[model samples]
Target: MPCDFLPAQRALLDATEHLIYTGGIHATGVDAIVRKSGIARKTLYRHYPTKEALVEAALRRRDDRWMAWFIAATSGYTDPRARLLSCFDALREWFASDGFHGCAFLNAAGEIGPATHPIRAVSRLHKRRLFEYVCTLTRETGLAQPDEIAEEFLVLIDGAISLALVFGDTHGADAAARSAQRLLRHIPVSS
Candidate 1:
């Protein structure tokens, strides 16, 4: 409840985040995270009472840091359309990294069968915020029926992630951009 984690705990959480995202929650154990982080087992347990707590912390930590990476990836884009494309590009970079798993939200959703799981709730909220942000961007772009445009982007993004994971190729990210461009063809844009 201290909000700020001590250095060792932070280190443990950071390592756990990478492990969980790269491998999985159940697949990665406390000892592995501790070893990977070079932190003591007692210290790890001191910060995280249970693996579930550690998993939650890992998810929150990853999400908190990801938005910054995403923002930077789209920072120079002059158009909202390009910003959206850049957003998926960031995802592609992540997916094609040396050790990539799939989407954290999607992964958590699969691990969590119980509706009451905190991680599941957080995943849902995270995804909802993403959709809302996409919709807001569509609105700001002066596009018609912005909500519909956002929904299309949502589908395209999800499909892209799925394909990228399915084929272990980054081309899905490029394909997703194309799919978005095609979807946007119906609406006319003013210069």
Candidate 2:
């Protein structure tokens, strides 16, 4: 992973992210990134020695940006349980967004075959962060078995993303949110 990026490198990363998000990691070639970034091939190589390196960096960038966006989106609700439920609301909004192409990490994972692949590691890291955040929310809400609840929430979130992608609609989020509500109904919310 790059500790820092030069202006040219930033351009390359941005272009690579856009291309990979819109297209797939394997489908977006180095030439495409260079063309989209308007950066020279030599400059790109200088910044990233290999395509895998560039892909990993782009995924890292997406993970940071996406997580920040999600946190901000869900931060508006004050109640702990509301905050937990806000995740699904945020997902619905994202699903309806113009640039939404499903979870970038999930998409990348499918494209990167090997479990040992660096891109796969990036994908796993993204999910782990998401799960941790959900766990924090569940704990704050005074939910019993925070780990289990968080795991369930993560599953619903991922399932909603996958369904939204497959159906080309926001109903998946709605369904997931409803299911989540039912799941939480049995758990006592902290006052």
Candidate 3:
């Protein structure tokens, strides 16, 4: 609810994010988070109450930071079509980045499979926001049925990311981009 986190809270969150990304949700315990953050257990409990709560906060923070990065990366293209395609380029860059470990949301979902888990809820929220962003880009293209096209585009995007992660192939993004181009060609542009 509150974006304004205290110094200790921020530290704990940062530690959690790094640890979870490096190890995993189940592998990274609260004790590790506290030790890495240099925050006492009492302080962590004061802020988060439970490990699940801290995990949710970390995922939320990551969602915010990742979306900001993605939007900024795609902003360079003036044309809506080009901007839409640029998302794949961004993914390629991400895949090639050091310490790249695939989509955090997907990873979190896999690690915490229960549908009712708070972390899974956060992952779902992140995905919904991604779909919404695609819809925004599609609207800018002045295409017929932007919402439907955006949904299809999101499927391609997610599929590409999953393929890249599984096969360790950056070219998957390019393949996805080509498919996106084909999909875009089918949608009639507004006059």
The C-alpha lDDT values of all candidates are 0.79, 0.92, 0.92
Model 1, 130: alpha-carbon shift in Å? Answer: 1.8
For candidate 2, what is the lDDT?
Answer: 0.92
Estimated TM-score for each candidate: 0.86, 0.95, 0.94
> lDDT by residue for model 1 over 110-139, one digit each (tens)?
878897898898787767777887886677
Per-residue C-alpha lDDT of model 2 across residues 137-176, encoded as one tens digit per residue: 8998887788899999999999999999999999999999
* Best-first order by lDDT: 2, 3, 1
Worst 10 residues of 2 by lDDT: 1-10
Q: Candidate 3 versus the native: TM-score?
A: 0.94
Clashing pairs in 1: none
List candidate 2 stretches off by more than 4 Å: 1-4, 188-191
Q: Tens-digit lDDT track for model 3 on 89-152?
A: 9999998888888889999999997899899999999999999999999999999999999899
Best candidate, TM-score: 2
* RMSD for each of the candidates: 2.9, 2.0, 1.6
